[model samples]
Target: MLVPRQVDPPETPAKTRVLFTLVFLGSGGIERSVCNVLAGLNPGRFATKMFFHHRPHPKSQQDRIPQHTEVVWGTDAFVYHRKMLPRFFWRLIQEARQADVIVAGQEGRAALLACLAGKLLGKPVVGMIHFDWGAFSREQPRRQLWGLRLLYPRMRRIVACGHDSAKAFQALVPVRPEQLEVIPNFVDGDKVRVAGEAPLPDWAVPIYQKPVVIAVGRLENQKAFDVLIRSHSLLRASGLDHHLLILGEGSLQAELEALVKSLGVESSVFMPGFTPNPHALMRRAAAFALSSRFEGLPMVLLEALALGCPVVSTDCPSGPAELLEHGRHGVMVPMEDPKALADALGRIMDDEAYRQDLSQRAHRRSEELSADRALRAWESLLSTV
Candidate 1:
């Protein structure tokens, strides 16, 4: 009878629940990075939910989101309107209560709202800084800056997409040094290389038939497509004869097209709007170009490197120099300097040996920024926070 004692099995630990909030889930670098992180997370250790202030459009990167994530659209609670902040706030609070940790997918309203909810619930909030703070502050309204100054410090952790971004943020905001963490944007190189092998579309075939320099990003001021267009014109004047392919759609499409016409590079420069796969184009293109005025580690740059495409980028604040390893893996030129960009592009297109060398270096550097490394860093941060 004394030997009949029974013992129960040990209980399993609960998975950490994480809630990520964003203003929208559109086809942007921030959205792509978030999708990658969500997909890379270990399901056994963490459970994730995503909250969007508005419903994603059909063309948005909604399909890229992992299947395991529970997505809640605030549009379901109330139609999104600038005047409906109180309703959105309450809805966010309801969602935040169930999460052990809250993450603002990008800075601005998302950060403010997440910080407020985390404070009220005594939960930790992680705010992401996705742009150079100096450039971002200049573009945002005073109220936005005020809100960030007040709420950013309250965040349990602040993640910057690049080191320069972190430095700019610290100089602008009063957050402690310990609160800041730099996690560069990363790409799944294997997936990128596979996607790069996809055949070019019918329209893009002729463009890629000859030598071409490609740029991919939203056709907006921040991207400085105008600068890229000017650089292309300069290259053509120098008799480089390489076509310019600009991908992605934005409000400034009309303006950029007009610039192309004015520069007399209309026949050579192509604006094809947004494409689901730019990797395919990068794989075949002679060179990849980034003419950004500023960036928070451009994902397109990393994608180009992963495909072993030679890169020529403007030395923009917070990203290009760092991502390119200060001209080791790719060429870096001064921002808005069409001549510098043109010279760099011409060099890559003209010298096959130099281009091949850059290609090898790019591929090697990309391995350092692989998804597996970033995933481990993210898992560590999530588990601790």
Candidate 2:
């Protein structure tokens, strides 16, 4: 008779197991903000794992995830929930059962899945709100709103990246004041400083020689890059010679290119597709512009400020006004007004002293968005529940 050898018992994990669920890993500010939190968390105290319903997009900031953090790519799909809900829910239950806390990023299906899974397993769940609900609901479907009203109150806590987002969310859903917490988006200052101070990549060094006004984000309607291009055309006509460089790729690329050509400012406007590293461009840029119709504490604006570039952004709902502090740090132009945007651009370009002052303030203000502080706030929240 063969004797069975004695097996050693598995040791328990010392750190708190946390699971983060995302509908998809795409090139968005929310995805990058989550990555920043992963980078800053105390690894010894938090064993983090990320679950994605689909694979990360080619241009996504998925690469920013730390080496120690485990990532699981689930079944692939185009949209969140609805048809995919059963599959995602089942998978989430399997993944979330062992975790001490579940933090769900993105709204709609991801939030519903996390909340339901957490409820089933009795795990504490944090619902992360990355968009201004007032602005976001305008584009969402009826069922999404219904789902939010039904499921949001069940979450242990709701985290809003924008300072004003909590108040905006309360108008849409029936969440208690205690359930809402405001934590602004954060950027890696040291990473930005290093990447920005480095020399421009070979491909851009030639065309980027001119004073460039850079804007970074997916080339989508929400970003309103067409408005930025239109404003640039006006600036050119008014004798401003700075070239406009818009980074990131999206569906609006073809239309934006067409608009640039039609406006006859094609030579002055450059859309270089998705750039893996934008901090270098930010470092060399004369100014950064954000023309979004709305936002929830834009990550690019924070990165721009951290890199010491002055900024001009639309006073969109929830974010720009709070970030600029009513125009103390940067210029806040009226939303969707090309004339107003052009005027603000002209002011920054023509006045060297004002630009320098904005740049100094931008750097000083970036310290307030420290990744450590944001992560500590998150850790405290996670531990409490």
Query: Which candidate leads the pack in lDDT?
Result: 1
Q: Candidate 2's error at 163, in angstroms?
A: 1.9
Q: How close is candidate 1 to the true structure, as a TM-score?
A: 0.95
- Residue 287's C-alpha lDDT in candidate 2? 88
Candidate 2 Cα misplacement greater than 4 A, ranges: 1-13, 57-61, 76-85
* Top TM-score model: 1
- Candidate 1 overall Cα lDDT vs. reference? 0.88
TM-scores for every predicted model: 0.95, 0.92
User: Which residue pairs overlap in candidate 2's backbone?
Assistant: none
Report residue 86 deviation for candidate 1 (angstroms).
3.3
What would the per-residue lDDT of candidate 2 be over residues 1-385, giving only the tens digit for each residue? 9999999999865888899988887767988888888878888889999988876665566669898899886676554556766776788888898899999887877887788888889998888888788887887788888888898888989999977887888989999999999888898888989988878889787667777899999888889999999999999999888899999889989999999999999888888887888899888888899999888899989999899898999998888888889788899989989999999888888899988998999998898767777888988987777
Instruction: Give the 10-residue window scoring lowest on summed lDDT in candidate 1.
Output: 73-82
Would you list the C-alpha lDDT of every candidate in the order shown? 0.88, 0.86
